[model samples]
Target: MTTIYLVRHGQTYFNRYNRMQGWSDSPLTENGVKDAKRVGEVFKNIKFAYAASSDANRARNTAQIILDYNLANPPKLVEIPNFRECFYGYFEGMNSPETWLLTAHQAGYRTFNDLVTNFDLDYAKDLMHQADPFHEAETADQYWQRLDKAFEFLAKQVSFTSSDPVLLVTHGTTIRSIVGRYSSEKQFDLTDPPRNGSITTIEMNQNRQIKVKDYNKLKI
Candidate 1:
């Protein structure tokens, strides 16, 4: 079986400012550095045969930091754009609260919380894909197709017989999509998002059987 550990990038300045940060770039906050370090510590003992990250700097840097602390010889990092966060289009870099107000209004929601209550947190993502007035954001199918191809590429590079697991550092939405689509656990919910720097473990067999061993585990 091939084991893969998926990690969400640490918090960023945009995350702290409540901004819509898809495709837009931002540096990690001080707390974000600490969070990545903590994740590194937690996985320090595990040797990774393969490692990768989204082309985005936040995810790439987080992956580098974790590998820095890895006791085992870390493999060369593969940076790929296929694992990038969903593009927010016109909403990129906008204050999330204000953006939500506009989105909620367009969706006939009285308030942002109402939208969340009605459609769950994914309402924002739904709006980005389905209701954006500009219609520039990627559709759900597009996003899934991108990730599907990315995973297929990664799986081809991974050997099922390897003892060391593979590691992938990516954004929240990307990680969430994978978990929601592949995890078999009954208790895992798509609406319950993973915290920054959280680790999710998945295993795939030669027969193409995929199993999520752990989902969104924040601590060791």
Candidate 2:
């Protein structure tokens, strides 16, 4: 079985500004760097077989910092475009509250949280896709397609079959959406964004079966 550690990237300028960050690049904030370093320290002893991050600068930088803190030889960091966050199109980089308000109202939701939590989060993602005027935002299907491809890339790696754990640093929404979709454990708080530099652990067998052992943890 392959142990996967899904890490949310550190806080970014967009996160501090409360802006929509999907598929939108942003630099890490001072707090972001510190938090990532803290996470690195927390994981300093755990040896990782492979380390990778999304193509986004925020994700890549966070993974780099964590690898730098590794006590053992850290694997080379790979940048995967398939691991990128969902495309928000017109909503990208907009004020997060304003964007959610627009989508919520258009979807006949009295509040933004109501829209996202009414059904599953994937349904909410489809709702957001529908809300985009440019019609370019990723739908549930598109997001899943990309995610499936990302998994394929991992499975292709020879070291992924080994017992050593692997690290994947990506965006907040990407991590949440993945957990919501695949994790059998439904007790997690999906409404709130995961803490910066938090780790979510998933176990995957050679059969490609995935199981979430934990979510949103500061340390393993």
Candidate 3:
């Protein structure tokens, strides 16, 4: 079995402004630094056998802050491209509300919440991809194709059978996608977004069944 501690990266400047930040890099806000520090404190005593994050600087920077506070010897952070946030194509960096409204209207939904709650992350991605004028946004298949390989990749890079917990810091949407798709809990809604710097625990059994033990938690 493999235990994975998934942490959403700290809040970014784009997040502060309520912008569509998928695949668009943004520096961490002031509070974001504090958020990382708090997570570091929460995990100070735990020794992580492996540490990784999406290639985005926000995730890397947050991982560094948490590692900085670790007293336990932790492995160096690894950057994984598959762990990146869903690419929004032309909607990147645009106002979050505006883009959501546009997509929602096109999808025959009254609101973003309604659209997401009724459908799923994959549906959201497909809608956004279709809405993109240049068709640059990641389709549902394209998005999952990369992310579905993530666990296998990490299991190979880290010791899947090891007893130690693995740290994986990534963006909010990426975390949401994983939980919405693989979480054993059937009641979990796709519209429910994870908080920045939150800890979510997921386990993969020998049969590769993914179960989410916790979601959007402030502490482990």
Candidate 4:
């Protein structure tokens, strides 16, 4: 089995402002830095065979901070552009949650989550497809295709042994995408959101079937 530890990057200025940050960039907040450090402290004793993050600075910096606290020799950090957050197009720097709610309403959804439970629409798949009356966004299909290829590549780097876990630092939506698309967890809700520096662990068999061992658990 291959053990994968997925971590969302620390909070950012955009996050503090409740803005949408897809493909856009922001610096980490004071609390975000502290959260990253705390994550490092939590896993200081565990060694990873591989560490990766999206090409975005937030994810790269978080991975670096965690590695600084790791007791073992850190592996080289790999930057995968495909692992970056979903591109929200015109909504990139807006209030992400608010935009979702408003746009969902425009799309005849009570809320983005309403699309899931009521309309049978997957937000991840349909966000870019909806008529936002603002700007075009990345369709859920495109996002999934990107993630599928990226994770497939990363999984190849993971050793089948359980001895060393792989660390992946990425954005919130990206993390949720990974869990939603690959893991066996059916109740995974992107609306609930993941806390900064939280960890989610997934175990993958040789066939690439993944079982979620943890979901957004913040031990710190």
Q: Model 2 misses residue 157 by how many Å?
A: 1.0
lDDT assessment of candidate 2: 0.86
Model 2's TM-score against the true structure:
0.95
In model 3, which regions exceed 4 Å deviation? none
In model 4, the worst 10-residue window by lDDT is: 116-125
Would you give me the overall lDDT of model 4?
Answer: 0.80
Q: How many steric overlaps does candidate 4 have?
A: 3
TM-score of each: 0.87, 0.95, 0.95, 0.90
> Mind giving the per-residue lDDT tens digits that candidate 1 earns over 29-120?
88988888999999898889899999999999999999998988888899978999988888889887787777777778755567645764
Q: Which of the two candidates, 1 or 4, achieves a greater TM-score against the reference?
A: 4
lDDT, candidate 3, 129-161, per-residue tens: 888898999999998888878766876776666
Positional deviation of 187 in candidate 4, in angstroms?
3.5
Residue pairs with backbone overlap in model 2: none
List ranges where model 1 is wrong by over 4 Å.
104-126, 184-186, 206-209
Clash count in backbone of candidate 2: 0
* lDDT, each prediction: 0.81, 0.86, 0.86, 0.80
How far is 101's C-alpha from truth in model 3 (Å)?
0.7
Count of steric clashes across candidates, in order: 0, 0, 0, 3
Specify the poorest-scoring 10-residue window by lDDT in model 1.
115-124
